[model samples]
Target: MNGKKFVESHFHKYLTEHLNAEIALNTIQNFDIAMNWIRSTFFYVRAVRNPSSKYELQPRMDKDLIDRKIEEMCLRQIKELQKNGLVILNGMNLQTTVYGKLMSKYYLSFETMKLFRQIKGSETYLETINTIVKCKEFSDFVIRANEKGILNQLNGSPIRFPIRGRIRSNEDKISCLIQAVFGNLTLPTPALIQESIKIIRIGDRLSKCLLEYLRLRQSNDSKFRCYKALLNALTIVKCFHAKLWENSEFASKQIRKIGAVHSSLLVNAGKTTIKSISETDARTIESILNLSAPFGNELLLNIMITYPTYLLDISLKSENVIQVHLKQLNEEYIYIGSHTVLIVGDSLNNLLLYEENV
Candidate 1:
């Protein structure tokens, strides 16, 4: 057969009819490349035709044709992922947000894809994929724990705790305690004092109880849920505190003046929440999309290192730079600013700047 005819025949007669019959038949939107490869590879390897096998393959199974088909299938799947703003690579689904930092990238390896196809039928394979996608480290922890027989007696029962009661008074009590301790002590920056207060707050007896519960949780499956809930609550507290510190007026005018010296400091750090971008800034963002980006702690560190004179804002900062001097908390907040550009990240280093418009 000629090249065009060969490609067309495989696509229509084999690919659509054999590999993707269910998808083509139902018009399903959520496409998973690994799952599709698993089903298709199984169909190709079978010796006997099942009731579902509607078409007979050409007697001579050309390996090159099969390889090309798989490649095209992967490309189509990747296109779908791209459209959804997700990335999948090397049998792994890369996280969009890791430990509270944002990253948008995907990767997939040929060998890993082939291995997934081979093992897709295993009972644990799907579970393993689900676990990894949710949190690879957590999945690995569970797997290791299981191998050690830690889960042998697990009934998957829920664990309950009075979380609401514990958290309700945590903020006020912690704040009062902070005020009592550091309220008397003078500090250069109120931000630093606030951070100190947070550190102290985390060390409180109640917080210690939560940490202890998490530690003891490893021995008992019944406590896992409670432990996780407590851990999540504590994390939220930390994030909230960090955000407050980021947005707080500098402890003194001297601090603010010092911060203003930083080349690209994000003044009014968390005041403006960025959801959508204008066409102008969107264009600039597109150019930097491929540039290495930092997430979570790394992003925080980048902000600190690049803008040594400034605070790390919890929210995403605006790209626009304002030349006018900013007033204290009571003053009008302005979003207009020049794009302050700087290198960010220790590993995946990239130029950091704000988007202006499309």
Candidate 2:
């Protein structure tokens, strides 16, 4: 037999068995309503198969009529079942303990048949039902949580810091930079260890400088100016390091690997630049400029160190250059005025030696 004929034969057989003398004579009308309801649901599902398509399921009088009839039939059946002590309805809703088990069994039997047909056609009815059940469970959990409880759970959680740009000294800044560069890939364990080593070395030096400045018997204004400069320099260094790391080929590769595993990471990276740029302290701007001028020159050189061909491109041009020695690195440092910017290869010893000279 053809598919449509087979479906009709089975549907008729089901109605014949269910519509017995024990059921009300009106049950024939209920059976028709139930069949129509199933057909309408199937039609709706087919309409939504290609969500991107312009096609839509329009409301029809036939569908509405069938739905109303089904509701009425179910209500009547519930009433009859309750009267016979086969089920119970408290107020409007059916009591699950009395009617739920039987209703579920009926639903399962019908659904299993529907699923078999769906599977024969290479569809996923069972999977869809399981997904719906999972979604419902999650929704219930979310709805039961109180706002205060949710807030409490989130209060101590770490905020995501957007790492961007370069900086001279902050550990947090360096960490952010490292994350930006290597965050997306399975970085060599040794690379991470090396980065930590660099951070600790830089952090120790910065701490020492800050401590000495703090212990000095300078006037309040002088001390405040020194403190401000130190803090600003640190913040800038951190930002710079984070950006440098993000732009590194190693970091980019890592990010690509991460993107392969988590689709959202690539999307987020494209959408944002630096994660965060701490506001420079207004009071420390001058001090920061003074303390950071030398380091900034060094950083600018470091940026172009890997690309030596870009060195001549960084030299400052113009009328007056008799006094200042312009060790042309890249246009990266030209805006910083007369400060000596030293570009060195990837050698920590060289970097340390240059800093000592400054």
Predicted model with the maximum lDDT: 2
Error of 2 at 287 (Å): 45
lDDT of 2 by residue, 1-358 (tens): 6555311122322331232221322322344444444445433344333221222223343546544544554566545545533344566533322222332333323222222222211113223222122221122122112232322222223213332332222332343323433333323345444554454444333333322322231232231223333333333333233333223322222221122333233233341221110122322322433344444344333334422222222333665322224343344533322222232212211111111112
Q: For candidate 1, which ten residues in a row score worst on lDDT?
A: 97-106
C-alpha local distance difference test of each model: 0.29, 0.32
TM-score, model 1 to reference: 0.20
lDDT of 1 by residue, 1-358 (tens): 6555311122323332222223322332234543445345544444122212232434344655554554565456544433333333333332221200111111222222222222221223223222122321111111222121211211111211111222223232233223323222233446435644554543332233332333233223332233233333344333233322222333211211222222112223321211111112423332333223332234333323332232233333465432322223312333232122221211222112212121
Highest TM-score: give the candidate number. 1
Q: Where's the lowest-lDDT run of ten residues in candidate 2?
A: 348-357
The list of candidate 2 runs beyond 4 A from truth reads 1-192, 195-198, 201-228, 236-264, 267-269, 273-358
The alpha-carbon lDDT assigned to residue 144 of candidate 1 equals 27
